[model samples]
Target: MKRFLLHLLFWAVYLLQDSIMQFTWTMSALPGMPDGERIRLAIIATVIIAIPKAIFTYFVVYFVFPRALKYPALRWWLCGETLLVLTALILAHRCLNFYIVGPIIYHNIIRPTSILNLPYLLLTIMDLGFVSGYAFTFKLLRMQLSGKEREKNLLQEKLQTELKFLRNQTHPHFLFNTLNNIYALARKRSDKTAAMILKLSKLLRFMLYESGKGFICISEEIRIIDDYLELQKLRFNERLSIQFHRNIDQEGSLLAPLLLLPFVENAFKHGVSETRFNSFVHIDLQLQNEILQFIIANTTNEDRIQPEQIGLGNVRRQLELMYHDHSLKVTNAAQVFTVQLTLNLQSHAKI
Candidate 1:
C-alpha cells in the first residue's frame, strides 16, 4: 500500500512538472497565453493532456521493472534493457502527441502554437530524466535489501556459534567428572579402570564426530545414550537399575545432533549418580503414528542434593533455539527428574 501511494505521488510530481514545461513553452510560443484568461485555459488543457500519460507511465514503471540479476556481465544487459524501457516511453510519448492527442485533440479550434509538441523534445531528455533516475532508484532498493539479508545471515551465524560453544562446554564438563572417577580407580590400579577408559574414548568419539554436526540420526543418539549408561553401569556394578525402551517404527527419526543425548546424560549425571545405592533412570523413545516421543525419568536423592541445573540449563537453551515452540515437557521434583520431549521428526529440517 505504501509503495502504491509512493508511486502515485511520484507520478503526480512528474505530471505537474511536465505541465509546467508545457505551460512555459506555450506562453513563450504565443504571448497571448500569458494573460490570465488564456493562461487558465492552457492550465486546464495541460492537465487533461499530461494526467493520463503520467498515470500510464506509472503503471509501466511499476509493472515492468525486472529483478533476479547477478554477475558483472549481466550489468550491461540491465543497462541495455533499462534504456529500452525509456526509449519505449519516449516513442509512446511521441505517438500520443503526433497520432492520438495532436490530430484528434487540437483539431481546428486549437492553434498550432498552442499545443506544445512533446514528441520533438522527448528524445533529447530521455537519458537524463527517465533511465538514469530509475536505474539509481533500483540500485538504492537493491542495496537496502542486501543489507537486510546480511543482518539475517549474521544473526543465524551467531546463534550457531553460541550453540556450538554451549555443546562444547557440555562435552568437557561431562568428561571432567568422568575422568575424575576413572582417575580415582586408576590410582588404586582397579581392573575396571581400563574398561572405563575404552568407554570414555567411544563417548568422546561420538561427541567429536557425529555429535559435532548440526543434526544426527535419532538411532545414533540412542546408541550413544546406551554407551553412556553401560559405562556408568560398570562403575555401579549391579547396584543400579535402568530401563531403556525404543520403538523402531520411527527408524529414521532425525533430530538436532545432540538434542536427546544431553537430557539422557543429564539424567544419569544428576539423577542416578547422586547417591550410591539403588538409584534408577527410565528412558523411552518411540514413534507412535508420526509423532516422536522421548521421555526420561531419574531418581533424585534428597539427602544428597545436587545442583539442579548443571547440564540441564544449557540443554534447555539448545532445545529452545533448535525447536522454538514445538513440544517440550519437563517435570522435576526433589525425588524425581523427568523430561518428556515430543518432536515431529517428519517435520524436522536437515541443516
Candidate 2:
C-alpha cells in the first residue's frame, strides 16, 4: 500500500509539471499567434524537450556524480567526462530548438526569426542548464538525507534488542538467588517466614510485571527497593548491619525500570554475604531539585570480592542507554566496596 501511494504521488507531480510548462509557453505566444496554433507549438515543445532533459539528468547524476565527482582520485576523469557530456547535450538541445521548436513557432506561432538566432539559442541552453543543475542537486540532497534516516532507525532497533536481552538475563539470575534465600528460611521454619513470603510476593510482582515495563513511577521503584531490602534482611537478621536513607525533592519523576537494582544487589552478593562477622551494607538516595544520587557501600570479605562482582556490566549498559550523561563510580578500598550513581531527571520528569 505504501509503495502504491508513492508511485501515485510521483505520477501526479510529473503530470502537473508537464501541464504547467505547456500552459506557460502557450500564454507567452498568445500575443502573436492564434490560440489553436500557440497551443499546438507549446505541446510540441514540451513533449520534445522532455527527451533530452531526461538524458542529461540521468548521465549527470547517476553516472557522473557517483562514479567521477565523488572520488578525489577520479576528479580529473570527472572533469573530462563533464565537459564532453555538457558539449554533447548543449549541441543536441540547440539542434532540437532550431529544427523543431523554433521552426514551428516561427512558421505557425510567431513572425520573428529572432527566436532562432544565436543569442536566443544560447539563452535557451543556459536556461536548460540551470534547471537541470538544480534538479540534480535537489535529488542528491534528498538521497543523502534518506540514507541517514534509515541508518538511524536501524541503530535504534538494534539497541532496543540488546537491552531486552540484557533485561531478560538479569531477571532470572536475580530471582534464582532470592528464591534460595527464601528456601533457607523455609527449611528452618523461621518465625519471620510468612513475612518474608509476603515481601517476596510483592518484589516478584514488581519484577515479573512492573519491572518489565519500559518506565515506572519513581514511587513504585522506591517501593521495590524497600521491599527487596526488607526481604534480604531475613537472611542476615542480627548478623547484617544495614542502613537505607532517601530524600525526594519531587514525587512524580519517572525512570527506566530495574536500572538501580544491580548496584544494590552487587553490594549484597559481594560485600555483605561473604563477610563472616560484623558485616555492614549502607544504601543512600538523595534527590535534590532534578538530580538523583544513589550510594551503596558494604563491608567486603576482601577474599571473595573479585568473585561476586557479577551483575554490574548489564547495569552499566542500561545506564548508558537510558541516561545519556549520567555518572556512576565504583570504588574498592581495603575492606569496603562502594557504588555511587547520579542521574539528571529534570528533562525526564512526568507531571
Candidate 3:
C-alpha cells in the first residue's frame, strides 16, 4: 500500500508539473498564441513530447541504469549520452513547438518572427529543471530502496540463523534422553548397557560440540550415524540390522546440521521398539550433477503402530521457510518408512 502511494505520488508530480508548464507557456506568450485554442494545442504538444520522455526515463532508470553501473565503461557512456540528450531537447523545445503550432494558428495569434520567444525559453528551462529534479530524486529513491532491501535480507537471515540454533538444540536434548536410558541400565550393572552408554556419549560429544555448526561434512554425518548404530546395537542386543550405503562421487559433501537424525529417530521409535525381531534400517547417499541425494528406509512390524508423534511437525514448515522450494521428500507407510532429501550444492563448474 505504501508502494502504491509512492507510485501515485511520482505520477501526480510528473503529470501536474507537465500540465502546469504547458498552460503557463500559452499564458506567457503575450502577442503570440491565443488564450483558449492555443492552450489546447500547447497541452496536446506537451503530452506528445512528455509521454515519450516519461517512457524513456523509466527505461533508462530501471533497466539501462542497472546494467550501466555493472560496467564502468557503460556507466560513463550512459551519463554522457544523458547529458547530450537533455541539452538537445532543451535547445530544440522552442523550435519544435513553434514550427508545429504556427501554421494552425495562422497570423492571428503567432507573429511568426516572435513565435520563438523569451517566454518559451523560460518555460522550457523550468520544465527541464522539474525533469532533472525528478531524475535525481528517482535515482535517490532507487539507491535508498537497494539499501533497505539489503537490510531486509540481512534481518531475515539473522532470524533464520537464530531459529536454526534453537532447532539444533533439540538434537542435544534427544541425545541426553537416550543417554539417561542407557545410564539407568548401566546402574543395574548390565555389561551391554555399559558399552551402549559409552558409544552414546561419544556420538553426543561430536553432535554437541563439532556438528553444531550450520553445516557438516557428509563423512562426519556418516561417522555419527555409524556410532549411533553401534549404540543401538548394544541396546538391542544384535536383534536389529542397520546398513549405510554411500555411492556419492564426493566424500566431503555438506548438509545442514541434524537433518538426517530425525528420520533415524523415527525409525527407532517404531522400527526397533515395536517390531519384535529382525527389523532393518537402510540408508543410502549419492551425488549427481552437484546435487546431494539422501535416502533412508526402515522396515516396521505391521502390528507395530507408526511413530506419528515423534518428529517435529514444525520442521517441515521451517524447511519451507528457509529453503523455499528446494527439494525434500518424506513418506511413511504402515510397515515401512522412507525419506529422501536433495540439495543443490555449490560448484565452480556451474558458475
Residue 41, candidate 2: how far off, in angstroms? 11
> What global local distance difference test value does model 3 have?
0.66
Off by over 4 Å in 1: 1-127, 304-307, 347-351
RMSD of each: 12.1, 6.1, 14.2
Every model's TM-score: 0.62, 0.71, 0.56
lDDT of 1 by residue, 1-351 (tens): 976777667656755665566666666545654466545555555555454355444434443333323355565666676667656655555555555444554443344332235545554345236634663575468678999989988888888888888888888988887888788788989899989999999988888878867667677887888888877787777877888998967656667776777787777777787766668888888877657788988888877545556577887777667764457777767778888988766564322
Decide which is better by TM-score, 2 or 3.
2
What residue pairs clash in candidate 2, if any at all? Answer: none
* Candidate 3 local lDDT, 15-70, one digit each (tens): 66676666775575644546776567666666655643554466566656777878
**Model 1 lDDT, residue 211, Cα:** 80
Q: Judging by TM-score against the true structure, name the best candidate.
A: 2
CA lDDT of each candidate? 0.69, 0.75, 0.66
